[model samples]
Target: MDTITHTLFGLTLYGTVDKKEMDKNHKRAYLVTAVGASLIPDIDVISRLWDTAGQYQMWHRGITHSIFVTPLWAALLFLICAVLFKTKDKRLFFLGWLAVVIHDTSDLFNAWGTGYLEPFSNDRITFGTIPIIDLVFWTIMGIAFVLSKKNKKKSPYYFKMAWILMSLHLIIQSIQGFLIYNQYDGKYDQVALSADFVPWTYSVIVKQDDTVTIFQDNLFQEEKERYVLVSDKGADLDYLFSRRPEAKTLYEWSPFVVVVDDGKRLGLYDPRFYREGQSFLYEYIER
Candidate 1:
C-alpha cells in the first residue's frame, strides 16, 4: 500500500485512541508512528539499490516486509519518538508496534508478494489476493479524509467505521482471489490476479506467458518489461534455470535469471523484449 492509506490508517487509529484516552500528544505520536512504520516494508529497495547493485539484489518488499521487523522497527522508532516527545504512555508504544504490523498486513493483499522471513528463509509468500492500488479504495479514503478534515467534530466513530469498511473490502477481495485461484486449470490459465491496498498494487504472476497479466478488480494488465516470472512449484533455483534456457553466459536466480544471448550485441531479454531484427532462435543462452 501507498503512504496515504497508511497515513489515513494511522490517523484513524490515533484519532480513535485519542478520543478514548483524551491524550492529544499520544494521538499525534501514534499517527506519526503509523505513517513511518508503513514505509518500513519498502526499505529493501533502498538496501538493494544502494547496498547491493545487481547480482540477485533484494528489492522493494522482501525480508524487511516480514512480521519480524515490526517490533524491532517500531521499538526503535518509538524510542526515538519518546526521546523527542518526552512522553510516557505505554499505549503509545503499543500503537507504534500495531501500526507497523498493520503496514505489513496492507501488503498481503498484493500479488507482487513479500518475504515475511527473508533473512530466515528466502521463500516468498503471497496469497495472490489484491492489487497494490485500487482506485475505489483510494477514492473512499480520499473522501473520508477530506470529509473528516473539513468537519469540526472530531468523532472517532466515523474514523472507525471507515477503517472497518476498508478492511471489509479487502477481505471480500481476498475471497474472490481464492475462488479465482481454485478455478485455475491448465498452465497460463487464470494466471494474473491483483490485490490492492490503495496506492500500492501487488500483482501475482502465477504463470508467465508472452505477456504477464496482472489481475486487479477483475481486469488484467500485461507486464511488458517489468519482471521475469518463473514457476516455483518445485525444484531449486539452479534446477529451474536449467529447465528455462541453455545459455553459457546465462545467470540464474530464484524465480528469474539473466540470460545473455549472442545477439547483434549483448542485451537483456526474457520473453518480453521487442526490438528490430531480433531472432528468438539465434538467441544465444537462457537461464
Candidate 2:
C-alpha cells in the first residue's frame, strides 16, 4: 500500500478505540502508537543513502517488514508511549502490534511485494491482487469518515465497518488474482501478474522460452494481448553484471526478465512493468 493508505489505516485503528473518557495526553499517545506502527516498517528506506551494493530494490521491502520485527517494534513503541504520556495503558502495545502487522501484511497484495518472511525466507511474496494505490480502499474509508461525521457517537463503529469492508475487498481481489494466475501457470514457462489500477483487472505476463507476452486481463473475460517481448536468449551477462551491479540485482529480483542485447547495450528488464517503448525497471550498460 502507499503512504496515504497506511496513514488511513493508522487513523482507522486509532478511531476504533474508545477515547471518550481519556485525557488529551493519553489520547495523543494512542494516536501516535497507531500511526507510528503503521509506517515504521518503511524506515528501511534509509538504507538507500548507503546502498553501495546497488541492492536498494531488494532492501527497501526487506527484513524490516518481517513478522519477526513487528513485536520488537511494538515493544519499543510501548516503552516510548508509556514514558512520554506517563500512562501504563497496555492497550497501546496491542494497538501498535496490530498496526504493524497490518502494514506488513498489506504490502503482500501489491506487485512490488515485501519480504514478509525476511530472515527466514528472502522470497518476495506478491499476490498482485490489489493496486498499490487502491481507490476502493480510499472510497470505503471515505464513506466511513462521512458517516461518522453524521453520527459522532457511533464513529468507532463506522471505522470498524470500514475495516470489515476493506478485508472483504482484499479477499475478493485475491481470489480473483489466484484464479487468473493458475489459469496461465500451465501454459507458460513462467508467469507474473501486475494488478491494474482498476479493480478486477490485471496485466498478466507469461514467459515461454525467450518470448514474453503481456495481456490486459480480467477473470471474467478473455485476455487482450498488449505487448510481446523477446529476450536475448543465452546472452553472456557476466560483463553486464560487472558494469552495472544493479542489473544483476534486477535479474535476480524479478520472477522473469527480458535480457536485452541489441549489439549496442547489455541490459535486463522485468517484463511486468514494460510500457510504451521502454520499461521503468530496465537496467542497462552501453557498449
Candidate 3:
C-alpha cells in the first residue's frame, strides 16, 4: 500500500479506540503511537541514500517490514511515548504493536510485496490481490470519518465497522485473484497477478518459455489480452547487467520479466507493470 493508505490506517485505528476516559496527555500518546507505528516500517526507504549497487529494490521493503521486527518497532514507539507522555499504560504497547503488525500485513496484498519474513526468507511474498492505492479503502475510511463526526458517541464502533468492511474487501479481492490464477493452471509455466486500480479487475501475466502474455481480467466479464511480450532468450545479459546493475536486481526481484534485446537497447521489465508501450519498473541499458 501507499503512504496515504497507511496513514489512513493509522487514523482509523486511533478512531477505533475509545478515549473519552483518558486524559489529554494519554490521548496524545495514543495518537503518536498509531501514526508512528504505521509509518515506521517504511523507514527502510532511507537505504536508497547509500544504495550504489542497485540493491535499493531489495532493501526498501526489507527487514524493517519483517514480522519479527514488528514488536521491536512497537516497543520503540512505546518507549518514546512513555518518556514523552510519562505514562506507563500497557495498552499503549499493545496498540502500538497492532498498528505495526497491520502495516506489515497490509503490504502483502500488493504486487510490490514486503519482506515480511526477512532474514528467514528473502522471498517477496506478494498476493497481488489489492492495488497499491485502494480507493475502496479510502472511501470506506472517509465515510466512517463523516459518520464518526455526526455520531461522536459511537465513533469507535463506526471505525471498527470500517475495519471489518476493509477486511471483507481484501478477502473478496484475494478470492477473485486466486480463482483467476487457477484458471490458467496448466496453460502457462508461471503466472503473476497485479490488481487494477478499479476493484475486481486484475492484470494477469502468464509466462510460457520465451513468450509472456498479459491479460486484463474481471470476474464478471471476459478476460482481454492486453500485450504479448517476447523475451530474448539467447541474448547475453552479462553486458546489460554490467552497465545497469539495477536490471539484475529487477530480474532477481521479479517473478519473471520480459527481456528486450533490440541490438540498440537491452532492457528487462515485469510484464505485470507494463503500460503504454513501457513499464515504470523497467531497467534498461542502451547498447
lDDT agreement of model 3 with the native: 0.93
Across 1-287, the per-residue lDDT of candidate 2 in tens digits comes to 99999999999888888889999999999999999999999999899999999999899889999988999999888998988888788989999999999999999998887899989999999888898899999999999889988998999999999999999999998889998888899988989998888899988999998999999889789889999999988777998999899999988888889998988888999887788868888899888
Per-residue C-alpha lDDT of model 3 across residues 1-287, encoded as one tens digit per residue: 99999999999999999999999899999999999999999999899899899999999888999999988999999999999999899898899999999999999999997899998999999999999999999999999999999999999999999999999999999999999988886888999999999999999999999999999998899999999899999887888899899999999999998889898888889887888898899899877
Model 2: residue 150 alpha-carbon error in angstroms = 2.5
Residue 246 lDDT (model 1): 30
List all candidate RMSDs to the true structure.
7.5, 1.3, 1.0
Candidate 3 or 2, higher lDDT: 3
**Winner by TM-score:** 3
Clashes of each: 18, 0, 0
Please provide, for model 1 over 144-191, each residue's C-alpha lDDT reduced to its tens digit, 9 standing for 90 to 100: 667767773755556666778888877877776676555443565435
Measured by TM-score, how close is model 2 to the native structure? 0.96
| Model 3 residue 181 distance off true place after TM-score fit, in angstroms | 0.7
Give the winner by lDDT: 3
Decreasing lDDT order of the candidates: 3, 2, 1
Q: Native-vs-model 2 lDDT? A: 0.91
Alpha carbon lDDT at 283, candidate 3:
93
**Model 2: lowest-lDDT 10 consecutive positions:** 270-279
In model 1, which regions exceed 4 Å deviation?
19-24, 53-59, 185-192, 195-287
| lDDT scores in order | 0.55, 0.91, 0.93
